[model samples]
Target chain A: MDKGRIFAYLITIIACTLYLLPLYTMVNVSLKSPEDLIWGPVAPARRLYFNSYLQAWEKISEPFFNSIKMTVPATLISTFLGSISGLGFYRAKFKYKDLLLFLIVLGFYVPPQAVLIPLVKFLADIGLYSTIAGLVLTHVAYGMPITTLLFKNYYESIPKEILDSAEVDGASLTTLYRSILLPLSLPGFAVVSIFQFTNIWNEFLFALVLGRGRASQLVTVAIANLKGTTLAAWNVQMAGAVIGAIPVAIFYIFATKLVIKGLMAGAIKG
Target chain B: MARYGNLQIFLFILPATVLVGIFVYAFSAWNVSISLTDWRGLVTSIRFVGLENYLKLINDPIAQKALINTFLLAVTFIPLTMLIGLITAILLCLELKGTSIFRTIFLLPLSFSFVISATMWTWMFSPEQGTINSLLRLLHLDFLCQPWITSTEQSLWCILLVYIWQFSGYVTIIYYSGIRSIPQEHIEAAEIDGASRFNIYRHIIVPQLKGETIGVLTILLFYALRVFDLVYLLTGGGPALSSEVLATYMYRMTFNQNLFAYGASIGTVIFIIALAIMIPFLLLSRRR
Candidate 1:
């Protein structure tokens, strides 16, 4: 290999290692008991310690389940809505369709700060305030734009001839959707739902403001509360952080390609 | 044919359209009207006050500081992330073995929640019991140890470093994909013309990434403008409000203090800034 290839290799490796330090710190510190803390985060732990994980689990396990209760329903509902909405834009052309499409997509662009106050008020007015159902609704509502956009983009990629031929056979709309588009959309649902899962799982502000009660608190909020103590709590906090992160991290381990596709879908089109 | 105004198509989109209309667009409109009021506290005193809250924000010292901090954070992190991302992309595209693993390692941070990152980064940036200062001491450079997030001078920069750490990987992957999508013939032609690897990158590869650059910059802009979780969690906009940005300030004002009108005003500022950043992206995507 030439000097250039060698230089490139060196730079990439060095950058990757340096970028990984904080994560390495999380895992390393989590595995260390208080007695091992003297090594000061750089040295390997004295032994494999599971105490902190157990301790952290005791505190965060409730919110961990809360996160699941919120995320699973929200992901399923939003991705389902996005599919039908996206397919709406896909199959048929209509007047003001672009305008409506633009409006929905525009929703995805606005900062969450823009709508926070009214959302709180509106949710309370409807009596769903500070509830997991409220969070699920908020996520689904906000999720429409991207989910719709993704499904639209996904459906658009399928050749127009397939749809035309199906229509020519006098197939009804339900048949066209159920028999043809539904089968083709499994991968699309995977990509969209994974995107929504990671996003809602990681979402902070909405949960912070809307899901303030312990009954509805998310793991992100729970983990954040763990961050209050500075030194003595490091081990447990890191463990909580690791546990809270594991759900999406599992996707990274197993379905990295889908994760990448979800991330890049909008970017490439834009 | 699946004709326009087909009852089925309209039915399919109704729920999403209604939800988006009410939650996203209408609430945004309500937020704007609230910004024009004197609404504060629990009781609904939606008295019209024009833009007084907005005008008050102009003289609000904390708001001023937050604006400057947000500007500094954006202007610093976005370009730095882009430059780092571009360089990393180029390096990874050098036909190296195990490049996929490198890509995963680089992009792993993107999968982490901001809260998780906030936790890890806070530990790393803690002044006394932190890894960074610990490393400095282990290097026998104990004198160089500094109060990281605890020091106002270093707090924003600490957040900036973490921001770059979190988002640059995503940018790198985008740029890598952009590089891969660049047609090979251009690079080959440049090589045939005696272009060195450096010259080929400088001349052929980077120039063709205009779309990716636009996309990456806008995405980074969106993140920069809304970067609250890390700063709020790590420093809590602390050490004298030095690292406070618009999002944190907005949250504190609206949620913590119940200054609904004032918070809405700040939210309006955020919305405007978002529109400013988004319109170009919108127009560009439309054109394409």
Candidate 2:
């Protein structure tokens, strides 16, 4: 009934429409039949159609699985490594400990271009160039800085007195972490794993240079190539993009709280 | 506890120290060395050129355009995103019904990969079959149907538009949570003093969102510096390298042309600039 409330609604509606327009076009066109192609992207699909999905799946499936094969191992290995290292940085006392952690965390901001040439050469020298394993290694290595920071931040949130008491009991490092830190770590694991999974899944540059071969190609690269392969077939291209986006999209939707938590924890100072 | 020792810390951090040390830091130093060479191809062709590439890069027209475009994108993008994000956050805090649903919808785009965004937006910006031009025609506004990515003039701005679309929602989310976290006492007290809502916000609320703005700007500046995929896929820095930023142009020089040293120089430029901006910010965060 008020003037400002009406304006607020109008603003919200306009913003949402702009955000959703491209998504609507992609979905609408991907579901159109060849005969319905004449209607253009402005219209909704004339009828339900699934052939584009099938065709797109056929082209992108192998690389989709390749993404999975690489991302899963990289996420697990990186998160596990980051946890212990986070604990190390949290508990360690040394002359240059802060300086060392500062250097490690600073790597998170290094432009990938700065490391690309040598990463490719390093992988090639080890005979792992253009391999899925090489990509997994790249992801894990790149994944270290943030994962360590996130878990270190997470572990620090556990009160010092709780860990102090555990230390008073004569428990060793491994035992304290096993019995105490791991249980308290479930939320941290959720946030860190989601962060790593979405990052590695969506990554393009590393996959482009390091995993260009068919045997190790990532889904992002495949979807990009799908455009060139099906150059005129907009339907197949949109469908392939939808498929490429599904995993990360699902994570953002279903685990939004954790995703935002990860984004904040990764980017902002805690 | 001292029994745990420095050895314990080093042992626990071994994997990260080694992996990040070699993969991130050492590789960066190696990249810097390669920039000092003229190793276009063949291992035997390698020769130390020593800043030849940097001198040439300074003179290069395309690199100059890219530097200008980067400054253009950053100068436009950062402020616009923050302004829009701040406004959206304020509107969401108005406590209308179903605000959570609106928040969720706004964030949906952030989930998409740039590859997906490129694919989708390329379709949306297609000259003949695009959503914008088509919708324009439907409204009988054919005069407004301008060439988007194909026109050299429009190409850079189009990339800027997409960058804003993908990122503003992220800034909004950070700001929304930030606004919610501000204690209610100040606003309540301001209202009791007969201050208008706008005045209350202008004087009391906006000033306190500094941390959120800094955090959001750090992320946005990083994207502005390293943006490649969308520009690479959407326009391929095309219509005469009109939309070329340093990343895509550097990629082409190195990978496509095999001008390894030239590209390495460009990469170093990006890295050095990033460090210059980021180091102070990192120190600030550490001090906090």
Candidate 3:
């Protein structure tokens, strides 16, 4: 009721409205036909046109599959590898430990563009270039820093006494990790998964350059290509945009808390 | 006593280390090498041309334009987004009703791909029958109706506007989390001392949120420096290279014009600039 509250409320409404504008435009554009799109503010010839959605769906389905093939395995592998390394760093004392940790952390800062050409050549030499496996490998490499950081922080938060107790029980490292560490780290896993899922789902450049063929192209590249091909069809492009964005939106809707937590953790710790 | 665990740590780290080493560090080295050579088209001949490519980059008009546009975009977007983000975060930290809903709604933009967001905005900014133009017409502000993305003068600002809209919420979530983590006792004690809300925030909260501010600013700076996706999708850095940023311009040089070495040089410059800015910020934050 006070001016402060009123001002906050007004700002909140404006911010939310600005945030929602593009989504509103996407939905409205998707509903309109090509003619309506070009005519500008004209009355729609019909309530809805399903053709654009159909076309977008048909065009992007293959790339959607390609994205899944590349993203899922890469996410799983990166999370698994990151967790193991995090546990090792936390539990085991090692020479060059600081250096290794620093190197892993440094991965977060290296610009992807810097490595694009060499990665292309490396993959090409190994006959993996333009393949889903190559795409997945590149993603995993790029993804490790944050994933390792997340798991390391999560493991650090765990009590050292628990691991000592497990050691006292004569449990081997592998057994302890499998039974105790992994189970205790489920929230961290979820957090990492959400981060990796959104990141890989939205990734564009590697998918664009590395996955050149229809066989390996991901949804982002597919949608980008659609933009080029459907230059005049605004409705179709909007439909494609909506389709390309849906998976990420769905993932965020389900795991919003975990994603936000993961992001905050990374930001704070970094 | 735990010295032998070094081997264990090495084994555990091997996969990630090797992957990053090969793809990141090694690849970066290769990118730098390629930039120094005259590699053309799909041709594999890579002959070192000393600093010729770098010299060319300094003089190339379009490359200069791209560098200017990139810095312009960063300078414009980073501070504006941070201010918006700080305000939103402060509001959310008030623990108002529906705060959870507000959190979720605000962070939703982070989940959407920049490509999709940019494409959708492009349509909304279209010259003919675009939503922006239609709205202007409705409000009898016919003078405001213009091609938002196509005009050379307006395109970069238009792109910056979209970037701000897409990222403000993301930065808000970061700041919100940061603000929440600030101990409540500080605020409460300040209040008990008869401190006004603004004074409490200014004197207490802002200083406490320094780490979060640095982290958010650094991420935004990196993003602004290397921005490509939205510009690529929205304008392809054109209506005459008006909206071109360094990354998109690099892509254009190599892919569009087959000036591979020139593009690589531009990319190398971008990397160096990013490093120069980030390393100092990181060191300063670490010192703090």
Best by lDDT: 1
Across residues B1-288, which tens digit of lDDT does each residue of candidate 1 receive?
Answer: 443347888888888789999987888899999999988888665689997998899999999999999999989999999999998888778869998888888888988998999988887877787888888888999999989999989999999998998888888888998999999999999899999888999989999998888778767877877878888988889988989999999999988898999999999899998888777778776585
- Model 3 per-residue lDDT tens digits across residues A181-234: 999999889888878888888988888889999789899988887775634376
- DockQ per candidate, 2 decimals: 0.69, 0.73, 0.55
DockQ of 3: 0.55
lDDT of 1 by residue, A36-155 (tens): 987778788889899999999998999999999999999999999888888887765678888888888877878999999999999999989989999999999999988998999998
lDDT of each: 0.87, 0.87, 0.80
User: For model 1, what is the error of residue A38's alpha carbon versus the real structure, in angstroms, after optimal superposition?
Assistant: 2.8
Candidate 1 collision pairs: none
Mind giving the per-residue lDDT tens digits that candidate 2 earns over A27-122?
Answer: 988898878888899898978888989988998999999999999999999999999999988888878878888888888888898888888889
Query: Worst ten-residue run, lDDT, model 1 chain B?
Result: B1-10
lDDT of 2 by residue, B1-288 (tens): 434667777888888889889988899999999999998855576889888999999999999998888789888989998888888888889987878878877788888888888888887888898999999999999999979999999998998888888888888889999889999998899999999978988998889988887889878877876778888888888988999988888899989998888888999998997788788977876575
Per-model RMSD to reference:
1.8, 1.4, 2.4
lDDT score for residue B151 of model 1: 94
Q: Give the fraction of reference interface contacts each candidate recovers.
A: 0.69, 0.70, 0.54
For candidate 1, the lDDT comes to: 0.87
**Candidate number with the higher TM-score (2 or 3):** 2
Q: In terms of lDDT, which candidate is stronger, 1 or 3?
A: 1
Please rank every candidate by DockQ, starting with the best: 2, 1, 3
CA shift of A236, model 3, Å: 2.1
Candidate 1 Cα errors over 4 Å, as ranges: A230-232, B43-46
Query: What is the Cα-based lDDT of residue B195 in candidate 1?
Result: 92
TM-score of chain B of 2: 0.95
